[model samples]
Target: MKKYSLFQFCLGFILILGCVTWGTAFQNREAFRIGEITVSPGEMKSGYLDVPEKGGIGSRIPFTVINGAKQGKTLALVAGIHAFEYPPILSLYKIKKMIDPAELSGTLILVHIANLHAFQKRIIYYNPYDWKNLNRVFPGDPEGSISERIAHVLKKEVIERSDYLIDLHCGDGNEALIPYLYWMVTGNEKLDQTTKKMALAFGIKHIIIDKSRTKDLSQSKYLGNTSVLLSTPAITTESGYLGRTDQKAVLRNVKGIMNVMKLFQMIEGNPQFTEEPVWIDHYEVVRSDHDGLFFPLTEMGYYAAKGEKIGYVTDYFGEVVQEFYAPFSGMILYIVNTPPANKGEPVYEIGRVKEK
Candidate 1:
């Protein structure tokens, strides 16, 4: 009887030890490390992602990492690809503050400002030093220009490290746009489906499934596209317009991102999705043919028939130099709001609505 009791006690102790070891391993699996910061499970760490600098000046991109208590997927939320697009960036700031690491699963990485120079100097599209649009250059060259180098660093440090990605943008200082999300239809069926699901869950009323734009892979250099190419499920969203960050726009973005977190199981809730989003299959940009002031006859989200006159441009003399017409019947996705215009500058983007 004494021998049997000792055996039972030893068996119980071994089982308890095994269970503790397994729990520790599971928690450790959720720990994340980026740059010099190592965030363990149930912890949140904020720091800067250092980028190589030239001309005696260095730059850093601010990042917040939320490593959850449970092991799951890793998501990277990026904003401020354009300096003046404030809604998305503001949403990220709120997300960083509101999320609780202890209540999360997996990890959430937030990049508040991807274009540091542009954001700091109030530049519109491109980096001041390189004059290169950060969005146009992705999976960038390490030895290339400042923008390219920044892109390269992001590709390596952020995109490659993430299991999923969400790049946020708003209309530039000169643009007016409706809230929408871009879903890339990569050849990878699984990734494409995952991205589409995420886009639908983003709480946006408009979702553009990009099949035509990426027909030529060389033209697909946006951060979201690049991330998709790397086999990571990714989506890009646009809200806000005309360079302003309204409370409604910011709240929409915040709610959308939170919905995404829920979709990823990083947060514990059902994702709130739009009932039926307008899915666009193809899109075309209407460019200005003459340098002048642009006047849009239709508002954003308005549908235009093919060959319909959408806008016109007037030269400095107040004479209409060019009248813009829609090439296809579609919803207006984007339009330039700034008075000044130049030849070949985008005046409007028409998204061809897809039939269910």
Candidate 2:
């Protein structure tokens, strides 16, 4: 048997007390920073993150930071990577108003609009100056074009700072889409699982078990994938379509983000996870080979059999130049609803559900 002294007991008691108080003390720590916005505990601030000028082209991204009363986790919600996707962009503005820092746990970063140039110009995917898709250029080049510069700033400011991230998006102006989310698998078990929970917590019924994103850091491509590859748990969510501003799609984005807040314990509530999630095992974005008018034979959210013609494209003179068919039996996640179809651009995306 070992004997203990009063000195040892007192020392042990003091250490225990320090550990207990340390947590509470750390929770009371001040300040959360991102871009130009710096928010103290129990406060919210909004500002712009400047993308430096490159060849007389520059833009400011709108952002809002809500620092919670107690420190826990930092969640970054980004919208408008593709400017024409209106619902997600609108959702962030609504969340900025709805969230009270006094009631939150950790900090909340709202990237109100990542593609301000595109949004201001009333455009879709590409940045007007460079005519390049903002989402396609990740970990952007500081010395590159306008879109590349925007990516660089976001990589340094937003994605690198957050513990969890959600890149909000929707179908562009030309497409019709059903609500769904991409749960990116990074081939890392812990990260993959965290993202899986986020997808379920988001409450979107259809979830793609997406493993298709490139592993190459230089060409990470999408914003969500860029975040994930950098070891942050992230998801890309789509909840609206056709450049519409309907309340339903907008609210869906808000609800999903709120539910994710619960999942991270950033708020005092349980996450409302999807009741029966439709697991999409595989997905393919069918691209057009010809520049012409597109006529869809099937609608978004409907099922298409393997080899079934989903749409067709005709030349400028109305000669059928090419036809698109489903590569596999799956659900039409999104399809071009408008007339224009260009070469090497997506006409539709199909997802095959995991069999029971």
The global C-alpha lDDT for each of the candidates, from Candidate 1 onward, is 0.87, 0.92
Q: Write the per-residue lDDT of candidate 2 for residues 1-356, one digit (tens) a residue.
A: 78889999999999999998987776676788776667888899989999987677789999999998876799999998998999999999999899889889898989999999889898988989999999999978899889888999999999998999999999998889999999999899999999999999998999999999999889998889999999989999999999999999999999999999999999888898898999999999999999999999999999999999898999999999998888999999999999999999999999999998
Model 2 scores worst on lDDT over the 10 consecutive residues at 26-35
**What's the TM-score of each model vs. the native?**
0.92, 0.92
Q: What lDDT does candidate 1 reach at residue 269?
A: 90
Model 2 has how many clashing residue pairs? 0
In candidate 1, stretches whose alpha carbon ends up further than 4 angstroms from where it belongs are 1-15, 55-58, 215-219
TM-score of 1: 0.92
Task: Estimate candidate 1's alpha-carbon lDDT, on a 0 to 1 scale.
Answer: 0.87
Candidate with best TM-score: 2
Model 1 pairs in collision: none
Best by lDDT: 2
Candidate 1 C-alpha lDDT tens digits along 77-104: 9998887899988998889888888788
Off by over 4 Å in 2: 1-28
Positional deviation of residue 203's Cα in model 1 after best superposition, in angstroms: 1.3
